[model samples]
Target: MKRLGLILLLLIGGFSVKASYKQDTTIVEFTDRGVKKRVTVYTSSKKDFELPRNLNLENVLRSMGVDSSERKKALVLIEQNGAKQDTILLLANDGRTVKIVAKDARDQLSRRDTLRNDSDHWSRSGRNNDDDEDDDDTTTYVKPKKKNSGGRFFSKSDFGFYLGLNNWANGASTVPSLQTWGSRFIALSFRRNATLINGKQMDLALSYGPEISWNNFMFEGNDYIDRSTEQVEFLVATKDLNKSKLVETSLNLPVMFNFGFEEAKLKIGIGGYVGYRVGSYRKLKYSDSRRKEINRDNFGLNDFRYGLTVEIGRRRGISFFGRYDMGDLFKSGQKNAAGLQAWTIGIRL
Candidate 1:
């Protein structure tokens, strides 16, 4: 009984001394539009001074020369960082300075080690764990477990844009008069990729996607695709023209098989695509006051075409892609640009 009394007296004396030292520690609390909130702020003020518990929020803000909106924002900041050591408000006292810090600014080991089955958890300094030492802030060792029996999805998906150059490919001759710079190719593609063969040295993946592509073949000078001659002919206009081109849009499905070199951080893929022409037209812009003219027609272009695609880049990021048409760009019996096929090279995002 005598020993218990002595321990109680010592604990009470320690608490009293601590309270005396903390009496001058003015904490800046947060108040939101007349509603009192709890946000602890340690301030560096004069040792003899003690801030009031219910300081007039409006008057205190007015003295700081802050407007009404700013006061609301400050309150919001405090509210968002509730019960956290958000920051320090420094009053002119000695050589003290304010310090702003994160609320749960515990050591970094408190974070979860997110990996496969070997993920180990770390406990914070003050957190009570099931271990023998309640105050130990060390990492809790976790044994590695067997991989999941069901397995994980080899999932990777993307929606990306491609922009670059376009041209025609034919075995007989070339459309050399086409403007290289103005013949722009654009495509929008959405794809899902999955691991086909996951191995130690290399990995293989299969990607299948839907693509919408546009080809603009801006011809040079007066050259235009003339459909009125019963065939698609790139004829020079007699009327000094300003602009002439043929536009084709298609909906395509592309399938690619990719090989990934893990250490090299490179992925190379080859595949094929099949597409149907959705829309086609020819436009003529006159230099004089004849006004811009547009003709909506197939212009002897084939309705369906299949092509080969090749991709190269990192597994995920801006990559390079190229496609070449294996079928005719024009119908087989069209007699004009019949063998011309479309091919494009561009960067994919």
Candidate 2:
């Protein structure tokens, strides 16, 4: 199952493109009041391009005498070409004046059938030289390229943390699961992934965090005590208390399978998580000496739980998500085991 998830994640992560280049160009096509236009420009290689600052399409059209009304309604098309290419801009209106320049020898010749005699003569001589050398070096040779995964889909993600308000319900309000109670708790978590198995899109990961929670409960086997009536019944009284606050810290391991659409920019996935409670905060806090609160540290909490997780993200930068704990956090007979289920809301970071 874990291997399956790892495969899913890697497969989903494989589609996003990440390449480095120094130069690029922008191609723009515009239609103003039914007029079509196009232009291209070449630029120096750089990591990022500043929009408008480098080339102002609006200003260019205005300089060409295009009317203000036509400019406002113009439909624009923009394409990012690598630094090696020229930025292309087009304006259909006669009002707009566009400066056209040749990017290379081919571009210069594209508009004319005229050929440079010297270049043609030089090409013929070069071809003759190539034929003589080709036979001399009969060893068909090629340079080998370095094999690298390169930084593709995800290099890293941001940290995420969240809490759920309605975790459980019982009698009057009970949630589906081992425990039941209307409660609120917070889950602070950190997640990371690794591609362990080959030929699969599943990823293995770890997440752990602490939580603070509050809930009401009636202890098993104890005489029911009603603080409202200031009465302790020997046989039928029910144990009644306002609420209890507890702390839980756990370590979780989850295996997930992911699937992506449109180059892994959009994704959806489902997986399961296993957890171990490393610490707990269950001691009661009281302000007065007249009514002493009891501690059930030795009787409650199983310390282990498991659940399923759903994830979605747009590359490694932006993600939104949720998680649900499906397993019990109690031993067979612990008193506090009655309430331990939790929920989480955090980012993919």
Candidate 3:
């Protein structure tokens, strides 16, 4: 009877030891600048362990062989036994945090791709999922279509360049003809487009943005622009006006109404822009010296300008644009200056 009892006691002790070893898990808590994070590490052995003493979180991650660049953006977490690892929390610079979890290998490409997909969804629905944690767990992430991806009529933002011909209309007697191909208007802008109506066949949108418009007007014949006083004058050059040109630059705010059809394949925008004169200059090429001379001045140009613009084309295809200024080129009190309104026509790419 004593031998049988001893054997049973030994068997029970051995089973308890095995159970403890199987359940060995270490919970590590990391605190940095009042921010606390926790991770659970499971171990097969029941031996006790401790993290390196007096080490920072960054140093700890480095010791784990994490790249330096990723250390700043990565959140390290360990899985709990039998608990679903369904979401990951991401921190942003503006104190906003987002949660993301990959459902499969296809969704685990790069962080950029993940954020881009989320951004497209947010842009379309104007809803952010960061604050809503109780929604359905199974989210199907389909890569967004590239149609009008570059410049959608209802997109929140887009950027592009503007190129066109620059000329002027004078209300006075007659303005000199411009060098047809030599005169040019060039600009770059950052735009915001808002959807008013999105439909299967047609869409209506509104757009507004800031732009820098550079106007280069090449003269015809021996004519040159002069601004000795409050008035802007057109003077005939003693020498040939080979490459004499006037350049005006302004900072402008443009607003437009846009219509799009067939998934933005055909788009038309009508808008107006208001600008403040930022710079004015003149360039002259002298035949005698065969040298180019540049002069920077206000040139009696108007301090403020307003203009109308029209755009028509395929969203990503070549588009035609036209601009006509409603205000005079120079300030009031310019004698015989007439209308002196500037205009441009060109293609937008």
lDDT of 3 by residue, 1-349 (tens): 7546534643553444333333322222222321222221111223332233333445434433335564454333212212232233332233222222312223333453345542322111112333222223323333323324343335678886899988877666555678999999999989988888866456788989999989998988888887777667788889865688999999999999989875226889999999998999999887777788798998878889998999999866778999999999887777656668999999887
Please write out the lDDT profile of model 2 over residues 1-349, one tens digit for every residue: 8546534543442221111011121112212112212232212122222122112345434433446664453322222222222322223344122222213232333211242221211000111121221232322222211111222222223245443443432211221231233334444454443333222222332222333222233222322222222221113324433333444556666556654432224555577777776665443333333344554342245577777878787644545666667765454443323444556554544
Most TM-score-accurate candidate: 1
RMSD of each: 18.9, 18.1, 19.7
- Candidate 3 has a TM-score of 0.56
Taken over the whole model, the C-alpha lDDT of each candidate is 0.61, 0.36, 0.61
Write down the TM-score of every candidate. Answer: 0.57, 0.41, 0.56
Q: For candidate 1, lDDT tens digit of each residue in 1-349?
A: 8446534643553344333323232223233234243222332324322122234344344332345674564455455644533432222224332212223322222323223231322111222222212222433333322112212122477798999788886735534367888898999989987878865335787989899989999988987877886676667788977888899999999998888764345789899999999999999998886789899999988899899989888855888989899998888878757678888888998
Backbone clashes (count) for model 1: 0
- Score residue 198 of candidate 2 by CA lDDT: 21
Candidate 1's C-alpha lDDT?
A: 0.61
Assess the local accuracy of residue 62 in candidate 1 as a C-alpha lDDT between 0 and 100: 31
Worst 10 residues of 3 by lDDT: 118-127
